[model samples]
Each structure stands twice: as structure tokens, then as C-alpha cells.
Target: MTIRVTQPGLSTTVQDLGRPGYFHLGIPISGGMDRFALRAANLLVGNDEGAAVLEAVFMGPALEFTVDAIVAVTGAEMTPKVDDQLRETWTSFAVKAGQILSFEILKSGARAYIAIAGGIDVPMALGSRSTYSLGGLGGHEGRALVVDDELSLGQAGLGAKSGIHIAPKLRRSPGNPAELRMLPGLYWHRVTDVSGRNFFDDTWQVAPEADRIGYRFRGGRKLEFVDREQPFGAGSDPSNIVDGCYPYGSVQVPGGTEPIVLHRDAVSGGGYFMLGTVISADMDLIGQLQPHTATRFIEVTLEGAMKARRGRQNLLDELRASLD
Candidate 1:
């Protein structure tokens, strides 16, 4: 089956779970920003949970299917439709040959996931079909989908079918004042006691600089760092630290100003002082936030973070069971 993009809506790109084991080489994991939604969409279309799907940012593309196809839309309420006929999200539906699939409006959230039966047949680089557009790797010509671009469909997986719907409670909603759990990083000591306390006390607003690479937050508080002599090779700035690996979701504050949370497509290492890292379970939540969204960072113990991780995994397991 083949699908053609009539209007490539904002920044639609093919993404899978992401390419791993290459961060040391400085290749960012440029997969779907919203993994939860990606998995849900894939499951609805009877594709593998990590199957490559189209991730539409803010807006969605106008697609013309050349053959009858089973498809699902999840994450961000982008009001998807088939030839102008409204279709509910978080559910699987069928699109007949010659039908046009498009999104009407972006009701909430920043990104949406659209998964077709089988998957977007893209050549894999480093065991992934994800598009790291910065480095120009993977996906269609290693970039976002453009107008008139024809995408090949892979063979349907074991349970390929339609009419699947996810429970409303299980659906992810981009609510205001998102409370993200975090764990203090190695450079947490660099922040003053008052600044450290205020970090979690104040609600930070997402800045206009937010994107796939990282999110900069403005809390109106100039964080004060503990005074100390600069270490060798660690810049003179108070927020500077010897270059170190930046784990995905790591939060760093440069010049004691706004804090930036590095996302899936961020640099692997940097000189900024990392204050903490958003827990893995909440990373998907970060993807849904838009500029000016209020967010609070709540510190959690390592054990607490682990428990949350397991709980999230269990939720996914339950979702898979419900489909069967």
C-alpha cells in the first residue's frame, strides 16, 4: 500500500522507539517525542508497539491513501478526519482507497501520533527508522515529510485489524500545571540551599525556546549558585561544570537563569550544570506541553523514580492485554 502526503502539515516525521547505543557518538535519540501516544497509535493499528509512525507537531498532514488501510491517531487532540468526516482519536478506523485523511484542528497538546497498519516503510539506520533531522539520518531522506511524498507500507503484523479503542482514563491528557517528578543530579550541590528549595517551590513557565531538543523554562527567579573556585576546564561561569554526559530529561540551568530540560534529541554532553533530571516515566508528558505551560519540578528519591517506572510499564502491559 502507498500513502501520499498532499499537505505536509507542520513538522511531520517518521519515528520508531529510537536508535540506542550511539549516544557516546553524539547521536541524539530522535524518535517520537511522545512515546506513550506512539505506542497507543501503533497498538490500535495492530502494529508492533515500536513500529515507525508519523509524528505531527502542532498540525497534522493531509494524506491520500492509495489503498484501503487501517489507521489510528493518538496523542494530542488534533481532530483527525477522513475526507472532512470527523474521526475520534485514541481509536482505530479504516480508510478506504482514494479517501483523504487530514486533521481539522489542534485542540490540545503539541504533538500527535498517526500509525497505519503495518508501518511507515523507511530504511533503518542504526537499527532504527527514527529521523534525526539535525544529523540528516533515517526516515524519508532523513527529514520531515514534504508535499507529494509517497510512503511505502510494510506488511501487516500478526494482529492487523481495526475498530480498536483505548479507554478514556488510559488516554494521556495535556493538562495545565504539569507536575514532573525529578531526581537531583550530580551538580545539584552547586545550587544554593535557597535556590534548590525554590526550584521545586515555584511553577516554571515553558519559554518560547521549547522544541524537540530541549525545553527552557522561565520561573522569574535567578537561581544562585554556591560560590566556589572554578575547576579546571569547567568554564568561569557559576553554572558551568566540566563537560559531562547529559542524560535524556536532564535539567540544566545556565548562568543561573532559566532551566532547560534536555529531551530526546538533545546533545549527549555539555558544560552546563545539571540540577536534576525529569524521571523517565514523565518524559512523555513533557512532549505534550506547549509554550507558556506551567510546570513544577518535584524532587523524588531514586527508589520512588524506579517505582514510577515499573508502574508505567505495568500500565503498558495492561493496555496490551486489553487489546487481546
Candidate 2:
């Protein structure tokens, strides 16, 4: 079976859980920005939790399926449609051969996942079918889908069926003034005590520069750095470090102005000093934030972060059980 792209939306790419263990080589773990939604969409279609699916950002693509298939749409609130007939988001449904699938304007959220039974049968690079566009690796020729691109479909598992619906409680979405819990990093000492307090107290708006690589926030007070003699190898700018490895979800404030939260496709290392990292549990929430959405950074202790991580895992467990 094959699916043909009729209209390639703003940014539609194939993604799975991601390509891990390659960050040291400068290859990021490129995958669905909203991983929870990706996994949910895949499970609803009877595909493996990490199976590759189309991740459409802002706008959605128009696809024409060549064969009957079980499909699911999740993540963003963009309503899915099969040949002009509206279908429910977060619910698996049937699409007959030659039926065209499209989406209405986005009502909420930033991206959506479209999962088909058997998943998108694309060649894997580095053990992942995810598209790392910057490196031209994986997915259909290593880029977003364009009109006329025909994607092959894998064999549907026995569990593939229509009408499977993810309960509302199982669905995840960003909250107004989304609260992102952050754990201060090694460079936290660089910022003044006043700046540190202001960071958490102030509300930041998502900047227009938000994308797969990182999210930049504006409207927050500029961070003031402590006076210090420049280290030999470090640049004169207070925000610059000699050079350091950036962990995933690191929040780096360039010039101590906008705080950028590096996401799935962010470069592994950089010279900028990071104030802290948004905790893993809250990273998914960042993906659903639309441009200009208000957000706040809440300080979290190591123990608190771990507890939240466990809660997220428990939620995933519940989702899996419900699908089963």
C-alpha cells in the first residue's frame, strides 16, 4: 500500500521515537516533537509505539491513501477529514482506498501526528526512520514530504482496527501560561540572584523563532550576569562559555536576553552558558505551545523532577493498558 502527498503542509516529516546515541557526533535525536502524541497515534493504529508517522506542524498535509487502512490523528486539535467527511482526532478510523485525507485549520496546539496501520515504511538510518533534515538522513530521502511523494506502507499487524479511541484523560495538551519545570544547571551561578528570581517570576512569550531545533522566548526581563574576569578560552561575552556540551532541554539565554529551550533537533554542544534545563516531564508541553503563548519557568529539585518523570511514565503505562 502507498500514501501519496497531495498537499504538503507547512512542515510535514516522518518521525519515530528518534535516533538515539548519535548526539556526540552532532546528529540530534530528530523525531516527533510531541512524543506522547506520536506514541498515542501509533498505538491507536496498532503500530509499534515508536513506529514512524507523519508529523505536521502548524498546518497539516493532504494525503491520498491507495488502500484501506486504519488511521489515527493525535496531538494538535486540527480536525482530520476523510474525503470531506470529518473524523475525530485521537481516534482510529477507516479510510478506504483512493480516499483523500485532509485537515481543517488548527484550532489549538502546534503540531499533529497522523499514524497509519503498519506505519510509514521508510528506510531507517542509524536504526531510526526519523528524518534529521539538517544532516539529510533518514525518512523519505531525508526531508519533509513534497507533493507527489509516495510513501510505502508496512504490513499491518493483527491488532490494526478502526474505532479505537484514546480517552480524553489520556490526551495531553499544553496549558495556558504553560508551566515548564526547570532544574538549574552548572552555569546557574553565573546569573545574579535577582535575575534568577525574575526568571521564574516573569512570564515569557514564545517567540516566532520556535521550531524543531529550539524554542526562543521573549518578553522576559534580561538576565544580569555576575562580574567576572573572562576565562582564557571563553569569549568576552558573559553568556559565552569556553565551550560546553549542552544536554537535551537546556535553556540557554543568549546575551542573557531570550531564553531558548533546545528541543529534539538541537545541536549537541554550544558555547552559550545555560541557566538550566527544562525537566524531561515538561519538555513535551513545550512542543504544543503556539507562538506568542505565555509560559513560566518553575524551579524544581532533582527529587521533584524524578517524581514528575515517574508520573509521566505512569500515564504512558495507563495509555498502553487502555489501548490493549
Candidate 3:
């Protein structure tokens, strides 16, 4: 049970939710940037939420599914075709043997998930099947998949038919202006009121300097100068002073200016403010943010965030109902 890729597009790698419980060893929670989409895709194909899936960047590779299997695509808005026909994403479907799947330029978002039944066959590293490019560990030889790469399923291959499938309501990509929500950071008051206002008021544009590791935004609106005391009152408050840990959705604002939103491949380290975390629910949508896209940060209340999370749970609840 495997599939062969004739072309691996710009970037492709295997990922699950992430490597948990090992952040203490300075292991970043390197995994899928878009957790929701990955989980949703897996659920669509009867795979566990932790199952590994292919996270494709930009367009995708042209590949042939040698084994008959079920698959689902999610995350970015890309034109995907299987056997020369358009394919529906966020839903499960069968791919006949020898069928080729091709991805065209992303139409809306920057990433997409292609989940194969039984999950993509990849060896686990550090108790997870994610790709950490910087460390060059885990997933397809510890790097982005290349042309002529063939992936195989491990134990419990897809033997059952896709009894049913559900397609989520297609979500449009956030426009050029995106008001991303953020929870108060541990160092919320570390910055001048002007800096805090700028952070929440000004719209920063996503710069070309972006990748799986993080996104660099321009026009972050400078912060006002302060007495610069022990890094306590200006936008320089770090989440922790420990050695290292899982850096998930942490926005590290360096020099009280440009803020980088750390993603899947962020480092496990200390010394940065880690001022805010992109609410877990929107991390995937954040992953889909395009280069040059403008974004604003709004402080979302904890109660409101909980409601948003529950709303997502409701969607999953409906999906489970469909499986019944």
C-alpha cells in the first residue's frame, strides 16, 4: 500500500499534530502548521487525528496512487486534479490504482493537506512523524519530499472502502486584510501604551520573508521608547526564562518592532517575549495567510476564545454524527 510521486512540487513533507511531551529537551513542536485541517482531513478518511499526512506547499506534485486508497485535501486553496480530473478536498474519495494526482498554483491559501488512508508511510522520529527541516529529522529522510519519492503505509493498511465522506463548507481565504485574534501575552504590559496600541491597531503586511519556520511581517509599527527597565514594561516580555520547550503559535517580538509568528518549525528556546499566541483554532488559517497579506491583531477574551474553540468542536461533532 503505497503511492509514488512523479513530481513533489515546491515543498512536501509528512506531519501530524506534533511531537508533544519532549519540549523540555528543546524539541520544538514541529508538525503540521495547520492542525485543524490535518485533523479534519484525517477524520474524513477514517484515520486517527494523530496520523501523519502530507503537507504540501505552493502547488503539489504529480503522483500516482499505486494502491487503491481514500484521501482528503485541506488547508490552502490549490487546484488539485486526480487522473486529470478536478478533485474535491476536505472530503474523502477513492483513488483508483495508477491514478495520478496533480496540484496547480494555490488559488487562495498557501498550504494544503493531502491525507492518504492509513496515513502516509513514514518512519517516526522523536515519537512523531513530522518534518523538522532545520534539524533535518523525521519524515521522508528528514527533508522535504523530492521527485520520484514513494511512500508506503505501515501496519493496518486501508482495507475497508470509504463507506461515507463529508465535505466541510468551503471556507474562503481571509482577504488582503485579516484581523487575526490574539490572547493577552504574559508580557502584555511590558510595552508602552503606544506600542500596545500599535500592535493591536496597525495592520502589518506579510512579507516575502516567510516559510514553515515562521512568518516575517513588515510595517509592524514601532513601539515608543521607554526607560527600558529589566524588560518588564515594553513589548519585550518573554513567556518564559527556561531552557526550552514547545513553541506553538508563539509570536516572538524582537526589538519591539517586527513580530514573527512562529509556526511548526519554531525553535524551542528562551529569551524572547513570546508576547502572544495565535489562538490555536486559527493557526491553520494563519498558515494559509499569503505573502503581502495585511493583518491586524485583536485581543480576544478567554471566554470568547473558548466559544470559538467549541464552535470548531461542534463542527467535529457534526462530522462524527455523519460517520454514524
Best by lDDT: 2
Best by TM-score: 2
Order the candidates by lDDT, highest first. 2, 1, 3
What lDDT is reached at residue 78 by model 3? 75
List the candidates' TM-scores in order.
0.98, 0.99, 0.88
Residue pairs clashing, model 3:
76-111, 190-233, 190-234, 191-233, 191-234, 191-235, 237-273, 238-273
Q: How well does model 3 score by local distance difference test?
A: 0.75
Candidate 3's C-alpha runs over 4 A off are 155-176, 229-247
What's the C-alpha lDDT at position 246 in model 1?
Answer: 94
Local distance difference test, each candidate: 0.91, 0.95, 0.75
lDDT for position 206 in model 3: 86
The better-scoring model by lDDT among 2 and 3 is 2
Rank by TM-score (best first): 2, 1, 3
What is the Å distance of residue 121 in model 1 from its true position?
Answer: 0.1
The whole-model C-alpha lDDT of candidate 1 against the native structure comes to 0.91
Error of 3 at 253 (Å): 1.9
lDDT minimum window of 10 residues, candidate 2: 170-179
